[model samples]
Target: MKKNVLLILLFFCLTDAFAQIDIKRTTKDNDLKLSALPYYNYGKGLGITSPDSIFQFNIRFRIQNRATYMQEEGEEAAIDGQVRRLRLRFDGYVGDPRFIYAIQLSFAPGDVGEIKEGENLNIIRDAVIFYRPNKHWNIGFGQTKLPGNRQRVNSSGGLQLTDRTINNAKFNIDRDFGFQVHNQNEHPDKFSYNFRTAITTGEGRNSTDKPDNGLAYTGKVELYPFGSFTKDGAFFEGDLKRETTPKLMVSGAYQYNNKARRTGGQLGDDLFEKKDMKTTFLDAMMKYNGWAAMAAYMKRSAHDPITFNPNDATDIKYIFTGSGFDYQLSYLFPSNYEIIGRFSTQKVNRDIAALAPDTKEYSIGVTKYVWEHAFKAQMEFTLDDMTYLDNTSKQNWYIRFQVEMGI
Candidate 1:
């Protein structure tokens, strides 16, 4: 009985000592007045703030796992699994809050692909400096995503579907070295306007030298006729916030690339010959009461046909003369479940109609947002049908399952 009492007393004494240390640490932390960090995954990331509020740093990491099954008509099926993305990001401000910067890196082997020996690593996803002088004006420079397509601009971590559409895979502006100017004005009566423009090196990212000494110009304008989305909600899918008021945005963009080297502008392999090209984008988004809808149209035209094997005179892979239309709709339930549907079509220009085939795709998916976009599982199946002018048709299908989690 005496030994038992002694043990209990010893336990209490150790607890008290630890408690005092914790109290001292908490008191010191409180005295510094550090600001709380912000992240989609609550309390998952790290942040540090200086005592004087002149500097801040935030770090985050995210990963995506994916599995896919693909089959072509009259062919064997293929199953694959891989780590789709492994990314680390850093974002903060230097002396002033208005002057901010961000650096993002991807370490996935698939993303890095096969690199040649003796070449420097080029895994920088985003490295940009931003200056938001006021609520109405902002300027940025460095390598970053170009404001092009709605789906492409949306972060992959926040998608309601398993993956992006084929149209995005074929014709997204991706990223480039550039300088951008943007502005937005919101009215007191639930209306807003936004404008953006950029001048970028026509070459894609990580290019040490410019091939043609030409630049690309891009501009976009948007109007929110039914008030702006809350917390930039339009960037994410499935109306998670369930806004009480309807929110709508309509935007249009135009781009001109002078002597573009690549077939897909800022992405894809270099063309056999450089050519000038023009691209147009139109999109609309609506969100109301957990219901969301989006539609986009994209068109690209080149000044002349691009041929890989000039002697054969049968190549048109780098022409980049086509149009695509995409539409999507989704509804989020109170239980954090979502159902989504999408349709997309692509048509080659008449000049290359015989060499290229038209494609139409249909897809449907479901997502369980266990913790909003920060943690979710998604599945989607897509049917792709291709048609030739000669009445020949081919069909292919693919199913994908993905899980995403991030801090």
Candidate 2:
């Protein structure tokens, strides 16, 4: 089943590439980009633009491939790593730009878990209908990640944080399946806020329904009353084309999972829980010049139901705090170089501590602009430290170098 789904997705991607006609190109402008990342984690992206029509129509298609080389503890050599994610995405806006729709179907098979042979499956990453009323309000139907962390919102080029923080990956999937709404305040200084709530199966994107029984709720707000020089909808930071900003804020929120039970996937308890376990998160991100730093803490109770086993009979409590930071230092010589590092420590009272791995990493790299954007090269080295479900742990270092060309 998984193989068949994967085949169909690949076929559509290829067909789109060959068609290559921006059939309904928008007169407003034509912006087409194709970026492929073939690194230790191999991936590709393909996009198209059509001539605009009365409906103000546009179409885009993208496909991605992912593979990694992982080294296990007590192992001298590395082995084939998990195929983290295989995905196909379609995005388009309806007439007048009032309504839009998007769908992301994925095929991901891997993990340190038990894999029963002959079982391959695909899941919907984001199947949603989004609408924008005028310019201030945007609402969406379907599953999407809750806006809990600001950095996580920067998806494409937001943070240099080695990986996701403990608060994020543990609390949610970089995303979840649910309905969400957004709002922006343009005139009131550079102020903006987002309030979203959803009722989902809570199961990550890969699997379908189970027996758990409650709705999950999460919301976030941004108070950047001082708007930067951002044109249209593009981001603006300290300078042009920059999205992040230097602001002071007091942000807090909570997420609840109420289900009777759950079965498989990474978060067995993401969905289907009768008891409500609410995790409260509070933190702030501060930016100076091109560098930004962050610290966040969360406290969760034992009453939360696990998708695997739901029973009040077992109750325990846990509190965890994690801190991380990123640097945007610009080197005058030796091309343009940046240094980055992130680390998080976690301790849980009742949860399985073995599987709860704390992550720490350091990455330093440089990007060279050749022929004024005609070509570019990037080289980075990373060192990772992780303690696994087992008592012992392991760490590894890697050097990744790559180049890019665009016309």
Candidate 3:
């Protein structure tokens, strides 16, 4: 049974790592004079402090193991391996530090998705809560990710490929249940900005039953032009801090989803009517010295993007209205070894192009990072190229390997 639920989740993660090493050795051998927490580092994980410092915790976990092979053009050649992401995270601050919080969980059955018929195993990817009222705003509420695209808000353990693309798996809006507002600013060496917005529950992420009266609005903007890239590094993906002056970021986003009932609005399936979705995104990123680049563009729309089934007329369901593009580049070698490249394309919407097709892809990757994306290893290759609606075309190939680790 999934190896006894992975040995009871590895015996509660080794009994919480031996009860956090006996509470940090009994608070330093009984000196008990609290206020010292913050020791175990290595990518900043394992910390817990609450002796009146008003609650703070941080525990992290990550895993990703993957393998794959494929080939097609008349099929037959496939291979696979799994556990592609096992996550477990928690971050904290509660009575103050501007009240932050976060939680994440997923135990890999492809990170807990695909169990429907009234849902139940989506495994909560992030729970969110934040306020951060200073140094440039931030306000958030439950469930995360949906500033949409920049590789779907980056961080699939920081990528540089072994995943993501196919125009972010076909038009990425990927998470919901929100309320967010954010802002950022800078002018230090000149130029930086960010803005974000959200309002959600367009059904996704534990969406407890409200099948209609849709919501999901979103907005985003960002600009950087020459500032910001060192620590935030344009939100991770091969550059590993090598920016010695020359950085950039640009972003744009929009979403609507009023009346959306899925088919990829907040993520696929569950639609036999309701449509009104709209999406758009644009992106850019750059870095220097050790090079990096990115590009994106996406589009979605629905006015009558097909969804019929009033007692089935062959059971209809379309709404992957489409448009996509992606591009990437990478470099990184100062021994942290990286090399990546990507390209993607998409185009559905000839009224769903007879249920989707028209693709193009290409990828190549290599990574090693070892500790830069909290430990990594990757390999990728892809080719794809499809086209259909009876115009016929095909091609495929893939290969992958992965490994990732986190604090």
The best candidate in terms of TM-score: 1
Model 2 superposed RMSD (Cα): 12.0
Q: Which stretches of candidate 3 lie over 4 Å from their true place?
A: 1-50, 57-90, 96-100, 103-127, 130-140, 143-155, 158-161, 165-168, 171-173, 179-199, 203-213, 216-303, 306-350, 354-356, 359-373, 388-407
Q: Which model, 1 or 2, shows the larger lDDT?
A: 1
- Tell me which of candidates 1 and 3 scores higher on TM-score: 1
What Cα-based lDDT does every candidate model obtain?
A: 0.84, 0.47, 0.83
lDDT of 2 by residue, 89-157 (tens): 666565656787777665555322344454335355567888988777788887665665544454322
lDDT of 1 by residue, 1-407 (tens): 99999999999999987665423225655643223322232254777666557887888898999999999988999998999999998988999999989898988877665686654366988999999989999899998888887788888887888788777777678788889899988653488888988899977777675455789998989889977787788688779999788889899988898888788888766677788888888999999899999999998898665656666666545755789999999999999899999999999888778877899999999999988898999999999999998989999999999999988
lDDT of 3 by residue, 1-407 (tens): 99999999999999987665544336455653323344333447887766566777888898989889888889799899998889989998888989898999898888786766666888888899989989799899999898988877887888788788876776788889878988989663788888999998877787777555679899999989777788787778878878787888888998888987878877877788777888899998888889998888998888888878898688887777878888888888888888888888888888778777899899988888878998888888889889899998889888888889988
Each candidate: how many clashes?
0, 28, 1
Ranking by TM-score: 1, 2, 3
Residue 72's lDDT within candidate 1 is 95
Off by over 4 Å in 2: 1-73, 79-88, 107-120, 156-162, 186-189, 228-251, 260-275, 286-289, 294-300, 304-336, 354-407
